[model samples]
Target: MVSKELVLKAEIRKENGKKHSARLRLQGKIPAVVYGHKQEPQSIVLDLHDFTEGLHHGHKLFDIEIGSNKEKLLVKEVQYDHLGKKIIHADLIRVDLSEKVEVSVPLVFKGTPAGASEGGILEEHLDSIEIECAVTEIPESIDVSVKGLKIDESLHVRDIALPAGVKLVTDPELLVIACSKPIEVAPVEEAAGAEEPTSPEVITERKPKEGEEEESEKKE
Candidate 1:
């Protein structure tokens, strides 16, 4: 279970667009929007350092303390700057803990494969899985164990263990991991089904006759 501590306050901003966004960043505030269900989109601002720290802790759910009111919202989408170093904008979706929400969870592979020790390659087929579950039940990541997996062995989507109340929405037969042995290639042979070389006498008999060629040329 992963949890994060975030403090978000309700701060209204009338400014919009590139210039305004840049100015907000200069003031150490990140522009964000919150919307979901039957509610209208609410524009809000978050503390830059606090918002970033929450993300670093991998907490998508925030206990937003908006001004004098408190609201629990799930982090929906976070947009990064061009350099991919800073958070530019964020989207938060209000949710009910009792209702199931669909979200994609990252995949994590645990342990080393026995086949890898024997020079076999380990291939991962899936990087993430979608699941429908309560917002509070959302897992940070799903774990798949590859310990002692032999060559030619595979672990499918169904092999992963999910937390209680978390249901996998992906196909059960989807390949998640596979171990393959190193391939060996054989050399090509060009003499297959070829007849043995002819003897010198046979070669001489097959050759064009020198005297016949000269007589034919003279007649022409």
Candidate 2:
């Protein structure tokens, strides 16, 4: 799914430091930096709620407005709190709509596999794949149909069908998904009659001492 155009408002940040960033977060905002396109990096602040909501909706490309200036930017990274539940900071890079960019697109498996009805387990090896496409043509996620796969069947990166302008950047031989027969475990009852081998007992004779032997000979 390709994302719809997403627009956000940003403001230039004059101060830098952990304290200032913490203060911003307290106001429901996030510290961010924009760089790329041979331009100097710009420190900016974005609304935490709006940016988080956009991300939850799978937005990657954004049109951010700063005062009278507007630029297209792509999400580069998002830092979260130590608990990984809160957004801390974000990084965005400038992009041109006309240029091609490489990004990782999520995979969505569709339908139950045919192998599932046959007592086979369906395994997913990859959750996302790297792809190259026009910035404007970036997809939210790629759909992979698993209904056609039968027992012991598999799908590789090369088997996926992408949008017209999208190209796979991952290795063609990488395994994407597979359906395999479930492993069969032997029942414990079947081992009841099996006898475990026991080690044989060993015997050793002790030799009589020299003085004892001589005394015994005299008695004889």
Candidate 3:
């Protein structure tokens, strides 16, 4: 769940440009923008280390301290560098604690499926699911148990049991995972037997030449 105590301090981003952003990164800070709630987007800068640490700790909702005022916001999106290893920019959306919002949370599969004991292969199709819930009630991750899944059985988005205030936002018909029966291979002897029998070679007696046919008729 989003922690109300996780507050981030931000400052108005004055300089705006590629060079300015590069300079900010050099100082261990990144550019960010806050919008939503029908308000004008506000430019800001945040501490790279602190923001990354908060994200690593699963702090999605934050009370951003912008000078004398603080606003509750959700981490709507994050922009990463080309290498996808570093955070380049962030987009925060203002939200009310009591209002409902849609967010994607990680899916955690727990327990070994019963199908595994039956020589079934378990396959996962989704890594996360989208859900709707109050800002403060947003879950960090959703746990799905495959313990009861049997061979050839599957789990879909509709089978998920969400939290009290949470509601599904993804398609219910989407397959989340499945337990598949293993493929069976035929024995070498059986495979060979299944092949079609080759036809017997056809041989024709040599045709008699004109003189040989005449001699045969005379002999008859």
Full-model lDDT for every candidate: 0.83, 0.94, 0.90
What is the number of backbone collisions in each predicted candidate, taken in the order shown?
0, 0, 0
Q: Which model, 1 or 2, shows the larger TM-score?
A: 2
Please give, for residues 1-220, the per-residue lDDT of candidate 3 as tens digits: 4444478899999889999999999999999999998889999999999999888777889889999999898999999999998999999999987799999888889999998988999889998999999898887788899999999899999999898889899999999999999999976664444777799999989999999999999999
Tens digit of per-residue lDDT, candidate 2, span 1-220 = 7876689999999999999999999999999999999999999999999999998898999999998999999998899999999999999999998999999899999999998999989889999999999998999999999999999999999999998989889999999999999999976677567888988988888899999999999999
What TM-score against the true fold does each predicted structure earn? 0.74, 0.81, 0.78
lDDT of 1: 0.83
Superposed on all Cα atoms, the candidates' RMSDs to the truth, in angstroms, are 7.7, 7.4, 7.2
lDDT tens digits, residues 1-220, model 1?
6444356665766677878888889988888998998998888888888888877776778889777778888888889989999998998998887888887788889998988878888988899988888877777777788996999999998888988888889999999999999888898879778998886754445655999889889999
**Which runs in model 1 stand beyond 4 Å of their true positions?**
2-5, 182-220
Winner by TM-score between candidate 3 and candidate 2? 2
For candidate 3, list the clashing residue pairs, or say none.
none
